[model samples]
Target: MILADIPIPDLELEAHDGIDVPHDLVALSEPLEPGQMLLLRTLDGVHRCAEVVGLDFTENETIYRLTYGAPMAPEIAAAVARPPRSALRHWVDDIDVEVLLGELADAARRTATTSQAAAPESSW
Candidate 1:
């Protein structure tokens, strides 16, 4: 199975609805899978536990596409990035944990390789 140990930074979520949870949602240091619950924090100071509806990853970070209730608002759907994907909680028993782990491992490897390749030559 793919393995990763990325350090996660604590981030706060902005309140989208009045029922938002209070406090910053720390992105777990563990890997994550779709359909798991996540403590989502916004740029403001709102927090909520949302299920992973979808995911989009880039070289720098992963963007989560989340949903709350039926008849979702367009504004909430548009601004979904906050703590970044590196901080998501991955449930070990999650059905797709294997695949998610693989993808995360691959992404982490690619990032490491890219960074190493771009680094200046070292001198003893």
Candidate 2:
């Protein structure tokens, strides 16, 4: 899948860079489905990928629980590896849902290819 093939929503996020590690506070217009991958851009211009595990609303604010993963850009991998904390309450307003979806499709393709290569050939 590509960026043009997916439907994306407009979201507004509050910037939170109080500490050395920068993250965003995202308020989703709609509830995110489970296992949805998101592409977040940090305040310092780093692109990171995360999978949405759960969502909760508190005090009229939607909180998304994400499991942080590898950096999209190789240059910032080292920086993203070391973070000040691992809390998952922050949100970012600007994200390319299309790009995130594309990445997910690509990953799935790679996994399928690897599995096919490893499987033994059938005589049928």
Candidate 3:
């Protein structure tokens, strides 16, 4: 069965220059669904192909950060520098707080189980 089509906020991504690395990271304005790809463009004629390789969830927004395959434009680097301070804005109006809390509980349980399994028994 198909889930109801919900409009996703367009990914207004900004390129983050890797300080000590060769690649560049882009911050997505919206979370990319599984198996989705993107063709990104800029007004000054810059263009790139991208896909979400990783995601970081915050209290309100789930960030779909990606690495641009080629070197990012200087304009993009400037944009990246400016947004980090305010990227984590709160937008939990329609979000279910309980569901978010439940994820934390699940994470804690998973961590506890993994640590217990990894722990080695010692002789008394």
Candidate 4:
């Protein structure tokens, strides 16, 4: 099994659908396999978990493709990044986590179907 311990300054989901970490850039040993687990740890203690959907091997590096939900909703990210706060009628409460999550999953599924029909994205 491939093992990786990634540490990042920040976890950026937007601007790039999936991240490309040079095999030398992180504590990555061995090539990753499809369906393997990927754990991303951000500087602010915000951790995102994902499963490896694809793997590209370069001369000396491996690129992991791990998301269909390219850019997560800013609101969801913001809420998860904050420290727990018990406030009345807070913005966090206003967010319907379930609905937002359902929509996100559906959108991701659609995107995946469409993308699969097109040429595969280059993994640099």
Candidate 5:
């Protein structure tokens, strides 16, 4: 399935402070599967790119194993130089895939623009 086409419901992130950071707080119509890419907003509001690697189900809840990619956006890079040593494991309900692709695309455009502006002009 096209990742962009997938409908995303509101999600919450499990914060280190024990507070659940809600993405949108809306109910999900469909469930997210492994291998889907998503953008996660850290507690400080930095957006990180990630991929769902696996899922673990306990008697009570389901935890998702996410492998984060190196931050491409400057803001994200400044927030966290690297993903946590342990794989990002969060409850499935804590993730939101909505508009993730659009955000990434926008970040890419911004990076490209910045690079072009910094490049030296050719004399020719």
Candidate 6:
């Protein structure tokens, strides 16, 4: 989920370079049923967010309908195709890339610790 969609009160995002942008929730339900994708355009770049209604990942890359709104501008699309920091102001909100990355790393560490604790210790 993009930070823009996060239900934080008055939550505004700041880009890695310190820029703000606007966003809206665009969902594809009918033609794109059994799944939904969210597109966010921020000052940094465009982001693709999706949720599949059914759990199935036996394929190389899970195939789900691309149901989301994205920038149509060639330049914007090109930027979005590159990195989150390359998207412009549209569906995504600008956020601090370093901060977000740090948060993700911390979460990963916590998850790893939790998994290790839950695993049975075996001494050979």
Query: What lDDT does each candidate get?
Result: 0.43, 0.46, 0.43, 0.56, 0.47, 0.39
**Model 2 segments more than 4 A misplaced:** 1-24, 74-124
Candidate 6 ranges with C-alpha deviation above 4 Å: 1-36, 39-95
- Give the per-residue lDDT digits (tens) of candidate 5, residues 1-124: 1111112221333222122222222123454467866665443444456566776666755555655544246544433344433357542232233344455667778888999999999999
lDDT of 2 at 63: 61
Better structure of 5 and 6 per lDDT: 5
On residues 1-124, what C-alpha lDDT tens digit does candidate 4 reach at each position? 1223456554455355557665566556565667876555445444455567877887866877764243334334444444445546556444566755776677668667876889678799
What C-alpha lDDT, on a 0 to 100 scale, does residue 17 get in candidate 5?
16
Task: Assess the local accuracy of residue 64 in candidate 3 as a C-alpha lDDT between 0 and 100.
Answer: 56
Range of the 10 consecutive residues with the lowest summed lDDT in candidate 4:
68-77
Estimate the TM-score of every prediction: 0.29, 0.38, 0.31, 0.41, 0.39, 0.31
Candidate 1 lDDT tens digits, 32-124:
566766544444334344665666666766555554333212233222323334447644455456655675666667667888999999896
Kindly provide the TM-score of model 2 when superposed on the true structure, using C-alpha atoms: 0.38
For candidate 4, the per-residue lDDT at 8 reads: 57
Model 6 scores a C-alpha lDDT of 0.39
lDDT (10s digit) by residue, model 2, range 1-124: 0001112121212232111111124534445555776555554444555566766666655566655444355333333343323256354333444544566666667767888999999999
Give the alpha carbon lDDT tens digit for every residue of 18-113 in model 3: 111111233434446634555454444344445546666667655555444453443343333332233477454334456545655666676678
What C-alpha lDDT, on a 0 to 100 scale, does residue 25 get in candidate 4? 61
* Candidate 3 residue pairs in clash (backbone atoms < 3 Å): none
Clashes of each: 6, 5, 0, 0, 0, 12
Which candidate comes out best when scored by TM-score? 4
Model 3: worst 10 consecutive residues (lDDT sum): 1-10
Candidate 5: which pairs clash? none
User: What are the RMSDs of all candidates, in order?
Assistant: 16.9, 16.1, 17.8, 13.2, 14.3, 16.4
Clashing pairs in 1: 13-41, 13-42, 13-46, 14-42, 14-46, 15-46
- Candidate 3 deviant stretches above 4 angstroms: 1-31, 71-124
